[model samples]
Target: MRYFILFLCCFFSYSLQAQAPHGAIRGIWVTAQDSVLDSKTNIQKAVENCKKAGINNIYVSTWNRGRTLYPSAIMMERFGVAIDPRFGKRDPLKELVEAAHAEKIKVHAWFEYGFASAQGDSGAYLLKKYPYYAAIGPDGKGIEKNGLTWMNAFHPLVQNFVKSLVLEVVKRYDLDGIQGDNRLTAAPSLAGYDAYTLAEYKKEHGRLAPPINHLDSNWIQWRAHRLNKFGKDLYQSVKAAKPNVLVSMAPNVYPSSLQEYLQDWPSWLREGYVDYVVVQLYSYKLDEYEKILKETIQQVGSKKGQLYAGVLIGLEDGYRAKPELLKGMLELNQKYDLPGELFFYHAALPKSGKMLKR
Candidate 1:
């Protein structure tokens, strides 16, 4: 009886260790939009909560709503304030890095807004400063969708401007890595019809840009190719400036992300542009979530720990995911052989119950 009990303990321990290998990227995202980062005490409590939840990485927001969370020289020179006014002169990014590092957690500056100008600035500071830089749709209006305004990715000046924002963070902060998502390095498939982008396209292809039909296959591929080139350039730039700093991307699911947002992340991984790719598989149903997990495994083959799952813990719309759902998602990751995951936001973590311990 004693030998059987000992064997069972050893077997379970071995299984647990095998399921969770060393150096797995167990991360969670903390956005500036969260009120918890508004002060030093709140930020410390947030970091401590994550540490207690066994989070080892944090992807904090550096850019959002046409402002920066840190003291950005670029924004100060171009716009007015160096940091987001909601933060009240507090360097939340710096505080987050210090707090996370003290807890031995990795920090990545998530350029959440990337090339985006604003959601609806309505003649606000940034829009007033660079009105010409915003992207245009086929309707001859500013490219606005879901209330978000994006910058033209094909424009040389816009590309340089976005790069400067990212480089500023890398150079100014003691970060382990930098990241971009659907909003940063991407434009809507219906975008690129701006006067400048069209002129540039005509100059290269000897024709005006296509019409507003986003389903046009050739047009979609052409725009995606341009973004792909930008991705490669941005990747190289990040590495060139800081060779050891990791460059990561968390884009939406593939093919669909390409069709809608022109984010061909699998190709970026293949082209060696990203050090890590966190695929957003936010699903409410277990079967649907498991299906995406399988697809992620097939897509990220042989990369082995380079791809992490972006789990949706809670959303801003007051949607709190059940604890059982969260646990099942983690189990699916283990079954599919993925190493780790990053919850959408730290505030989504359960209040009292233990979650993600192993």
Candidate 2:
């Protein structure tokens, strides 16, 4: 019976490998900030694990603390948090990218813009340096949520500068792609449109600001457009700088929340800015995950690009997956012929690298 079981396993493994997704984006999301690249040995070990497991792509980093991982010339004053030669730090991005390429794996640089200053360090610097793009309350008071600082998206310069900094990474690195997390839509029903946005809105849209007490449709719509613009400009900038490299976006699934908190990801997908996007479905339930996957893929609507379904492995959010989870997910993959599946973070992959192995 044990031999019979083994036979079945080998059979499935070979069969799956024969048809494994290729020419399709497959990888895990990794970061280089808030955490150092696990020692070079570990970094190579992780890449080796991925190659052995048949994973072909990795999304790593270039920006943190409003600072670009690559050494900078422009952001030195506004958000560049480091100065010493260590600022560039021994070609961190290059080594990672090279390792991945050596194993036939592709590396895409991940950029988490919008919310800056993980703790209290960079927040205070940006606020004091550029109050124009810095956060302020409706009462015209500066807003601070514990330690997370936000950039004023309404400022044209803010958008341009952010896009340029991101472009710097694309220009400098031979990245396989760009992994962009559209993380700054702010919140729905969030208060404090502020005098900065109000004045800008009047000038751009030719309308007096609506009262904060009432939800403003025009304002919301305009914000969504700006969000779309960010994606458009960033994608174009990266592609223009490096034509072969792809672009990816990590966005939440809830549509309303995306519009209110994320600037409307649907529009970004439809408009063709994102080369690919992973809907962080973060689902634990087999059926629910499949449902969200179907819904998100439906949005791509014949656009020829990769759509990696983000799986929630460890956390139990109704989408918490267990042993049967991979089986169920593979069932969906077979049904739709999905290009690949993406786990939220590099650390989240099962210790054996077995689930995403095939």
Q: Each candidate: how many clashes?
A: 1, 6
lDDT of 1 by residue, 285-345 (tens): 8889998888877876666467788998888897877878888988988887777888898
Worst 10 residues of 1 by lDDT: 14-23
**Whole-model lDDT per candidate:** 0.81, 0.64
Error of 2 at 16 (Å): 17
Q: What is the lDDT of residue 179 in candidate 1?
A: 89
Candidate 2 residue lDDT tens string, 232-307: 8778877788888887777777575454454576666677777666778776678887888788777766542456
Q: Which stretches of candidate 1 lie over 4 Å from their true place?
A: 1-22, 350-353
- Any idea how many clashes model 2 has? 6
